[model samples]
Target chain A: MARVELNGVRKTYPNGFQAIHGIDVNIADGEFIVLVGPSGCGKSTLLRMVAGLETVTDGEISIGERVVNQLEPADRDIAMVFQNYALYPHMTVYNNMAYGLRNRGTPKDEIEKRVRKAADILELSEDQLARKPRQLSGGQRQRVAMGRAIVREPEVFLFDEPLSNLDAKLRVQMRLEIKRLQRSLGTTSIYVTHDQVEAMTMADRLVVMNGGRAEQIGTPMEVYERPATVFVAGFIGSPAMNFLEGRAEGGKVVVNGAAGLAAPADIPDGPVLVGLRPEHLAVVDGGAAMLELAAEAVEPLGADTLVHGRLGDGQLVTIRLSGTPTFGEGDRIALAAEAANLHFFDPETGRRI
Target chain B: MVENRPFATFVSHFVLILGVAIVAFPIWITFVAATHDGVRITQVPLPLLPGDQLFANLESAFFTGVGNAREQSVGMMLFNSLVMALMIAGGKIAISLLSAFAIVYFRFPFRMGFFWMIFITLMLPVEVRILPTFAVVANLGMLNSYWGLSIPLIASATATFMFRQVFLTVPDELLEAARIDGAGPLKFFRDILLPLSRTNIAALFVILFIYGWNQYLWPLLVTTDKSMYTVVMGIKQMLEAAEESPEWHLIMLTTLLAMLPPVLVVVVMQKMFVKGLTETEK
Candidate 1:
């Protein structure tokens, strides 16, 4: 219902270990922002700070129009679904969803109506609503957790890896359900997960975090296509973006004392890291070759063949090709990439050049 | 179970039966002695079989106590013991639960210092500090009251430690969820924590009830008036009177009554007690 803004927010433990650096992100109303990172990257900490579950050490967080740094989580008008379903094991599903409203002193009829409505939206049957959380399957328990959040009807929803506990097939189904529910409800939401695929599929805009800092924030495609830093470029894609140590000379990248591959024209002549996504590299004949790789291993995944090997300079490289590839181990192959698909980064700093 | 040798199983059953008989021997002897008249009970070798005086002895023990203690009914002493046991068990659970909740959930100054202080009480049992505790009770004018009988015994370190362990095992996310649900500290305790620790509470109640009922030194030291005597202490008084005139049938009957309530409690709540002792949660 309202936008959320974090201005230079940070979190430092009492023992002098800083978990989150100053982070600023402005989420539009009804936008779904997924905070994606590896473990210890502070994604969950940042989300908790927004939920008023953790103290903001340095900056202001405003949900709607009020600065919520000092507000209790309930007073912040937000609901969170934890990684574990966190359903009250003693209470029935109906009571679990209605707990927040009942605590807020909502009338009996209204609490019942809202709980029933949430259960209906979640596709939970009446028979299931009377059962306890332990009686439900993992997926059903997850939906009840969501129903607990939905019945609150708060200004925003916060999901902390809610689907991570589910089985793989159930995770996909719940992911789609969450996406559809968020779209239908149009509630401003912030979801935190370590799965980049979930971030790519579900986020209106994705924030890639690293080392307690927001490394990049953009739409999934925008971040995937033009990652702002070497970290993002390496982190976003499957098989990860391949990097080669080389020096840029006159619009060409010379690697291992060889000058054959062309660099982006804007990259100046200096020591640089050449970045190429695995999918961007194509197996080609000798006429238009970017680099030659000595194939050390091959993984044929039916949909795409992943070739992992070493280049001439002994740097590891991976190349992805469509369909099944007939390449074997220890095969010397030439690969090519379009000039526009190449990324250049300064060797001194990890920032994009 | 893995080998399922019939000879080993027979040996195990025989040993278990022997242990049960050894433990149950006193109760069997008490029942047999209660079935005899006073002269028959005092015979050279007491009768092992039942006599028709069981109901007569029980009625006399229930309506009028043994020997010099006849002024106060044994029934009244049993009632006093029940009240003391219930109060001690209830009071300990309530105090320990609140203190454990405060210690685990809230951070304050000297928190660990206070927790250690409570834990130190475990070493100084009632028998160790009986004189000072009696002085305090007398100063508080609680000397001949049920409060005198139970209150000094209610501040339990073992119960607090057990509850603290149970609370610590509760998931942190449950607290966070309750906070988001707009539940304050007390509501969360009442709604979530109390129910979650129900089995633990029941199990502790069984143990503490027996402890309060079996208290001999503290009750004897505090209650000089015969009317305020608990059943366990009353049994000792009856034995003292038996030195003058042996009322063995009535004394044995009173002993049986004193032990019945706690035994019944354990027997009735055996399942919950075992579950509480073994498992914390689902």
Candidate 2:
């Protein structure tokens, strides 16, 4: 319903500790944007600032063309679902969902109608609506929290790790439900999570943050295929991308303890960092192998086997192979990567080339 | 208790029964004395068994009145005590609830200073500062009135501190959520905090009611009119009649009447009292 924009926003505490250092993101109307990072990386802080829960120390946040830095959270027309499902424990599920509407002085029949509709959409039973929050299971409490937000029909919905409290199976189920709900409602939403998988699956575009700065903001596939920095390449992937210290000289790359590897012509002759995705590496014939790995350990997942080993230069690498692998511990495996799959970064700055 | 160890259970039950007997002996004696006529109650070694004169003695104590305090009946004294206790309990809970809410939630200047100031009053109870308190009440022309008896003992530091602890345990996100729901401070207090602390309030009311009921010295000093006399003070007046023998049966009956309301309060709110003292549910 509204496009939310953050223009060089920063949050500085009174004691001189800075939490968020200048983040800017222009979220389009009805687009779901996710802010994902490790804990203490200021992703939550950024979301809180936009929600008007925290004061913006610098820059402007405008939602629907109005600067909202001075507005209260309620005045900004945003509803947030907390990580712990911050439902009113003493009130029944119906009152918990209708509290905001009642506070806004909505008519009794209208409030009841909206509440019933939200509960129905959330799949909460009629009997469950009359029960208090403590009586509901964890997932049902989460639905009540979602119902509370949806009943308001606010312009923007903010979710702060709402699925993190549920069990694993419920988390997955609720994740799909949330995505489906957002698609049907077409409300502009900003979700914050420390889990990269949640961010990748839920966001129209993901803002991968580190140390209070947006390291990369792109669609999941775009960020995965073309990481802007070594940190992004490492943080966004499961099993993580492996890095090796190497040098590019005279149109060839010489990695430590390996035969000469192919390099793009544009790469300058200097010390560089090489990145290779685990799944991108394939088992090749011995003569065509780009690097020989001294196998150290093996983890056989049902669909794919993970081979963790050390390259000859003593750099550890993990290789994801389809199906069961014939090689076990202490067996050398010949692995090779296509020229396009190798990602190069500068050794000094860790920026991708 | 259900461990299937018969000897251990027997020992524990024996100790509990012994404790109950020790505590209940005086109350049992009071009941027995109330059952006899005045002359029989004053006889040697006192009566250990009930007599048929219990109704006669209760009627005399409830309607006709006791010696030396004959101008006002025992029923009137009980009414006075009831009013004072209810006022004190309700007033203390209200004032302490507001003060505690202010101290915990607001960030005014010198907030902790104000809290410690209230905490310091715990040392200066009515006995310690009775003269100044009585002087102030007398100057305000509240002597021989209900306000003089209840108001002097209403501001409770213990109740304030207890409420502060209860408020502190409430999660911060609840406040944040309520704020986003557009509730102002007073609305939040009435709708959220009061309901959340319901058990604690009930528990504090029970204790404060007893405290107000048992007040003797302050009520004795303030009320000169016979109609203003509290039940506890009336019992002492009954025992101190100089010219004639005390009405032992009537005094015992009045004492039994004085104990009823507080006992009723404790019994009625027993579950909430235990829960309030033990657990803080979210």
Error of 1 at A122 (Å): 1.2
User: What 10-residue stretch in candidate 1 chain B is worst by lDDT?
Assistant: B273-282
lDDT of each: 0.91, 0.92
**Can you write out model 2's per-residue Cα lDDT over B131-228, one digit (the tens) per residue?**
99999999999999999999989999999999999999888778878878888789888988998898889989889999999999999999999999
lDDT string, candidate 2, A1-353, tens digits: 89999999999999998999998899999999999989999999998898888999999999999999999888999899999988887899999999889999999999999999998899999999999898889999999999999999988999999999999999999999999999999999999999888988989999999999999999999899999999899998888999988999887788875777788888899898999999999988899999899889989989998999988779999999999988789999898999988999998988987
| The candidate that achieves the highest lDDT relative to the unseen native structure | 2
Interface RMSD of 2: 0.9
Q: What fraction of the true Cα-Cα contacts (under 8 Å, chains A to B) does candidate 1 also have?
A: 0.70
Model 2 chain A lDDT-worst window of ten = A251-260
Shift of residue A283 alpha carbon in model 1, Å: 1.0
Highest-TM-score candidate: 1
Report the C-alpha lDDT of model 1 over A1-353, residue by residue, as the tens digit. Answer: 99999999999999999999899999999999999999999999999998878888999999998899999999999999999988888788998898899999999999999988998899999999999898899999999999999999999999999999998999999999999999999999999999988999999999999999999999999999889899999889998999889988888888767645676778788888988999999999977777889999999898889999998879999999999776789989988888889888887888888
